[model samples]
Target: MRTTLSRRSLIAAGASLLAAPALAQSGYPNRQIRIIVAFAPGGATDILGRIVADHLSKAWNTQVIVDNKTGAGGNLGSDLVAKAPPDGYTLLLGTVGSAVTNQFLYKNMPFDSATAFTNVALVGEVANVLAVHPSVPAKTVQEYVALAKSKPGQINYGSPAIGGTGHLAMEYLQSLTGMKVEHIVYRGSSLVLQDLLAGNIPSTMDNLPAYIPHINTGKLRALGVSSAKRWFAMPDVPTIAEQGVPGYDAAPWWYVSGPAGLPPDITKKLSDEIVKGVSSPEVDKRIKDAGCAP
Candidate 1:
């Protein structure tokens, strides 16, 4: 399903946080702030969540922690923040699934993704790479597609979650190329990478960061990237669109958000701090090093 959330809405949606009874601006964050990461600890979400949490902690002179609440394609953790009191203390390092896409993929969402939380700040977008174990026969996108078509549903590929961009990008690839493959869904990219390295899984479409080191070490072969253009970190790897599949761009982004109904002052403060932290030269380089553009 296509997303109704446009680029403009995404930018605006990123400027809010939790809401309800507004806390006094001066005394708002007297306690520790919890930023829930709705995925496993080694994925892009967890990495960026910790960066933002550290920044917030120093900025506010208080403790900020990233709580990993994994399961049900991130709905479990996102729901925790949605139901949290709109005091701004509880926030979410949200992904596309928790923010928008899951609303279409799941039949009965626990919380209204549209109304549950406020968008505090957009972190950055990361490319999803289609990489295979070195043992796989295919070495390029065309080869992979041809191989999948030959084997039909026999080929198994792993992704972080069902509704996640990694999975959707693969689905989009199948729709465009008419190739049938089985999806082996995992809790996060870290786990998928572990299995892929162990030769337990043949291939994966996941965020570029965690796969970069292995791709460089020849543990995995990057067939194509799911971005419009070449990713800076892996410039040698061509985009999916460049390799016979035109218009195949499916980059996922990260953001900070809190329960809906956050006070305007608190929202602005959090948004400003998040934007500042993400834009800092030091943090900027870190994001780039992690294979994402800050």
Candidate 2:
């Protein structure tokens, strides 16, 4: 038989558990918070992650650090967060690549979005632009399809990686048009952009923000955007679906999430703070300037 604890010991233990909720509800984040970015530094995701971190640090009066864990197309970093403690101290600035598309691409993932974490809030949406080098000889989506059909497998497109949304979006486009195009994977979007500008790769589907300035300067040609509705920043361009590929829409989105089993009070506190931070006018303008819809 187990010995019974003294009344004072039992009372202290019970009080601690009872105080947990109260302490958590007092606007959590009383300590340092780590926001993991599942990508390398200097990319759009990293840049935006830093922006959010700065805002959160200022608003919460606590240290908000960004830790980049880039590998396996953002899987390594994501899995890290998925297994972290369910406390509010650790958070993930997850991307569409890590959250939604990876589920369809990977055979065995370490975590499931629905069960591994709680969605804090949506940060922003990055539209994919269908762009090609000037030598592709296709000015419109229909013309591009005709050209690809006529010379099946002759046209090649590049993406950040095989399982990235850029790759899947192009694959979806190919399925819709019944056209064949070789897929080329690059280290990152910057490398892809470098090759596209140099006429090494004929075409690619990438975040519009990366290529928007080039498109504006006539360095690259934008055939269409991936959003169903026209982008507010680039209203003149039509969406890929509206142009011809029906039901075609894809964009990389960013959101905050914490590991499963997080206390409701902590989860709610984080969600409210993140949503408020992303909704601020300054952050909204920065996101819009990046050619993403926040």
Best by TM-score: 1
In order, candidate lDDTs are 0.87, 0.78
Q: Estimate TM-scores for all models.
A: 0.93, 0.87
Model 1: per-residue Cα lDDT over 172-256, one tens digit each: 9999999999999998888999999999989999999999999999999999999898999999999999999999889888888
- 4-87 in candidate 2: lDDT tens per residue? 211223323333343344544575677899999887565567767887888889988999999988777778888888999988
Residue 170 of model 2 has an lDDT of 86
Weakest 10 consecutive residues, lDDT, candidate 2?
Answer: 1-10
Per-residue lDDT, model 1, residue 172, is: 94
Instruction: List candidate 1 segments past 4 Å from native.
Output: 1-24
